[model samples]
Target chain A: MWLTSKIKQLLMVMKPGVVTLNYPHERPPVPANLRGQPVFDHQKCIGCGGCSDHCPARCILVRDVCQELRVMLYDGSRCTYCGRCADICPEQAITMSNSFEIACDQKEDITTRMELFMMTCQRCGRCYEMEKTNAIDRINLKGFRYDNLEQRALIRKTSETFDPTLLQQSDQYQRPSTKE
Target chain B: MSKRKELEAKLIARLRDDVVCVEKTDPRTIFIDVKRAGIREASKIITNAGARYLCSVGYDNIERDGTLGMIHTFALDDSDQFVCCRTSAPENDAIIESITPDLPSAGWSEREVTDLLGLRFAGHPKPKKLVLADDWPDGIYPLRKDVPHNLVPKGAEDVAYELDEAPPGTKIVPVGPFHPSLHEPEHFAVYVDGETIKGCDYRGFMTHRGIEKLCTTQISYNEVPFIAERICGICGSVHATAFSQAVESAAGLVIPRRAEFIRTMMLEFERIHSNLLWLGVAGHLIGFDTVFMQAWRVREQIMWLCERLTGNRKTYGMILVGGVRRDITPEIADDIRRVMKTIEDDLAIIHRAIEKDTSIHKRTKGVGTITKQQALDWSLVGPVARARGVDIDARRDHPYAAYDEMKFEVPVLDSCDVWATLVIRVIETFEAIKIVRQCLEKMPGGEFFVEMKDSIPAQRHAITVVEAPRGESVHYVITGEDNRPERWRVRAPTFPNLQAVPLMLLDEQFGDFPIIMGSIDPCFSCTDRVAVVDLQTGQASSISKAELDALSRQQQARHASLKG
Candidate 1:
């Protein structure tokens, strides 16, 4: 019984000889739909902040510098590459590029920053376009957000309109102290 | 009368006025609110009615009612229903009667709630610190509504978890927080008398990332499926599907039929890959490299196919709250069929090779024997339970997604050992292939994704179970004011199966430890540092990674010399 089993095992081993790829040297073709690093189109962006609202990892940050300008920063260091931002983008501005080979020495290599010129709505003073049919898709944080871009922190505070005091306060945002 | 009404009548008859109310949330779920004093009696009544104990869920209701809520969930498998016994205690006096005395499997759930929510289980047998770090400060329960999600408390040095006392005339052998045999960072202190094992104690959840708390507080309901998919590396789609179904059931959302078929296919794909991965790991545990190599070689096709079907290779990110993100195009369906055929042929060759091997039989045949009664007591799931003859499969019993229409056989073996688990997994792999083919053939054409018409109402509770490749994964959700859930509890299969390791290790050879533990297919991550202490002298000191590596090399050399 042992001998017969050994012979069968030998056949199994010989059948799949050397199936591993030679990785970097002999590259396999990546599929077209592979969710890799996300790229943002600054020209097509409407500063809606839908992607930032829907992001699971909270890697995308939206800060309204003023009524006219909005700063969107994609911190690649914490990004899960789940392609959720690309899926939730109202405009076809965010695309998941097939760039899986994105290991880098500097964080800035993969990070994307988009500064868009916003055309604010006269009624709300914010540029977000809510889904007319589904109320659940509405953005939670309205008006203007003052997220700290330098520290990569989401302040979770918003004003009715763009507030200078809030922007200045968030610029010096520190992590909640343990000493309290 | 229906099973729900019948069970409610039984509970009411036994508990009398202690049964506060019975609410049938859905066709398959019955939520019974009982007084805190009669929780143990209520659980006993339910168990006597042939309902299997699932897991316990605890949440903070102090803001609204000044009480802490606890729900003990159970599955009436024969009737395709779930019975959730809900009870609460005021914040000033938050104590509940322990159900672990009646059902041993409730031990971890009660201990976890105690550690996280500060709800004391009065008569829990061994309620040591289960989920929290030793240095975590007292009187600061992290699961409460007042606690912030990102609070990091100060860490205390020289803290160690106390292991259970070894049996008389037996020495304790520690295997991992970083042992070579264990792929993950779990610590098992095995007690042995010479070469025969006496008992064992496990201290895991070392890599618990507080995912449940984070999802409840930070992310929305729609974003949680992605986070839930990341709970386990192997069963990504299983957790995602389970969480989505929980939310869908809570909001009374009916998904399209094609979406259900696609979800079924994705689950079967995961099962196929996971079973083959376990087969490979099992072979490697028994020192058979050929089986490991050939099995994984066959399993690689499915990973690539998933990469094409979904976007990524693992963590498919395909499942959402309403439905799946990607549709099964006809071309992709054909591609799946081609891959399935190739995998079936290759796996058959490997199975025939390993089935009658004497070396494997010697290693695994009677190594981890546990009776079916012990399995029932521990409430084991998946292949582990099926191997020991506790015939239960959540897919067939509960019939989630498209499984109600699919035809397949759940194989049960009575050998009650590691060998039976191996055989069961192989047969299940073939069964998974059959399910996938049937999904492709019977898939209806319709919309894959559904848009939620309105925001989910608050305080609606739902429970869902998806049979993951490893075992059954139970997800419980309660909708909150915000887009996120009020409380989401995830019970992975390893949570219960690992508790029974001490029982399975009794009277077995110490060398068979790796295969026995590997049979459960434990999924966890690694830890960086290790501390060594001399129990005799009461002295403790830390060891550097370099010294630990050199010591392990020396041990390996000594072991090889003895074998030679």
Candidate 2:
């Protein structure tokens, strides 16, 4: 009877297959609803600083460097990643990304800088880069020289409004050379 | 029905200090405010009324009243009333007569007051540092009005929580801020005479995050819950829910009925997981590999459910002020119900196996018996208090969140041993399951959160208590004009219960010390440590893990040889 009981216990141990994950080699499956670091959609950003103000950790810095409203930065360090910013985003522009493995050697690498493109100015009828326009058009950009001023302005304006049609428009309407 | 009235009448008549106000706070407890000179006489009068002195804590009331306030509680055995005798002293002369002579448990309480508030405990035996580091600057109490807000009390000091000069024959054993045996970081110096622990003094200053101070400085009222939740890795939800409830009560914010149900669900889920974790640890401590494996296997079920529902296995970031971060959908609720069924089946088997194990009986039975009277006098709470038959559970007594609607039983046992505590926890797991089931069925659908529109008023104070898995978590919030608590006291349950460990471990075997300490369910992250010294300086060799293992091996070999 004791031998049978011992065999039964052994069978209980042997009944299960190996359940441990190969953690590093093959990544374990994360749940669909896992709340990770906040991912900011630069295209939808209004530069209202709502996400920054709502963030308890104050890890986000959204500033209109001049007035183009695209100069935004988020610091991974000091961010609790509590999903508050994602939860409070009016535009659904901020969502928690499933990228928890965020480690870097340098301080600059930690504060990931994701810049947004400028949309076409409705009033100017000319394409201008959001950040570059804020620097050059709005803030009297004299310190930094632009080589291809028109192209830079076009790229900035297209990025600001974030219209896919703007990229198609750029392809269709290329500027004619002055000599031609 | 008039039991409270009768007690109040007696207190009023006996004291005869018409100047001080005495009011019944609870059914059997009276709150009394007397002059500093009247404390001793008042305490004696209350004690004569079949009351035992619980503990005295000093609060820095300079911002409000320009004086330091000391409050103490005395309780009766049969009655629920604990007469709270309070007195105040000026900032310069913050002194109080020590009540250690009347009540031995007040030894640690007086030491805490002395360390935190810089109060002089007159004629207290060994009023050394209890919770502060030894090298903490003299006259700079972290909880004092004079100490400017920013400076934290730091550095190791020469004070031991319980100072014991090692006897000439006894050898001192130091077990770590970093030891294999200790899962948490704590420095414990054990003075052992052979196998018996002559004195065990714990000192730790490593895990100090200054969480309380951080809560006050950085987080807003709505955001404070989530910030406080990150204090401990294990019981994050408990801290978060408790802190949130406290702020909600203070602000008079009416939480959505659905939000209350979600909060209760989260809290019970936490209790189940935490208790399961403890069961695993206890099993591991007693050298029961199979039992440990079984406990952990069941624990993973709960962990999986937590991860699925709240998105984290450990820290469930599901708490928000006036609401929860995420509400459980119908599909997710079904998954939780399924998970609960599996856990219930596993727990039934585990419970029977644990109860039948002779090794468990040998190891835990009558090992750390804290009698009913001692438990009450020490102001102990949670399963530890319940095991000793003190009959105090914050969940039942102080109904917060949706607990008022939920039907569940609070597990209590009179054994007062390690076994009794284990039984209470086991029973509580079922109660937690009952709560979770009720919550799932009754979860209402509504908006999860309310927008904080009003700014925090300045100079307004509010006290709120919530039942965490461990015990009552009290949060004292004093809001500033800018809508943030200028001074927030995040009083976790572990802070008070950790005080009773030294008293519990008295006369216990050195080998059994770890298990006894573990029985209390201590959270060392909130606690500050002090370094203890052996006054008699001689290089004495101590017991090592290798030596202990070798001895056990030899004993096993001898037994096998004799049987052969």
| Each candidate's interface RMSD | 6.3, 19.8
Please give the C-alpha DockQ score of model 2. 0.08
Q: Point out where model 2 deviates above 4 Å.
A: A1-12, A43-73, A88-92, A114-180, B1-11, B14-33, B40-58, B63-65, B71-87, B99-110, B144-162, B167-169, B528-564
lDDT of 1 by residue, B64-169 (tens): 9999999999999988999999999999999999999899999989998898899999988998988787768778788998888778676554567899989999
The true-versus-predicted C-alpha distance at residue B107 of model 1, in Å, is 0.6
For residues A1-180, write the lDDT of model 1, one tens digit per residue: 999999999888886678889998999879999999898898778777778887888888988888788899999978888888887776779999888998887778888898878766721523444532444555766678888888777777887777899999998887653444
Predicted complexes: DockQ each: 0.45, 0.08
Interface RMSD of 1: 6.3
Clashing pairs in 1: none
> Candidate 2, residues B35-61: lDDT per residue as tens digits?
787677677767777765545656777
Angstrom error at residue A137, model 2: 36
Per-candidate Cα lDDT values, in order, are 0.87, 0.66
Question: What TM-score do all the candidates reach, one by one?
Answer: 0.94, 0.77
Grade the docking of candidate 2: incorrect
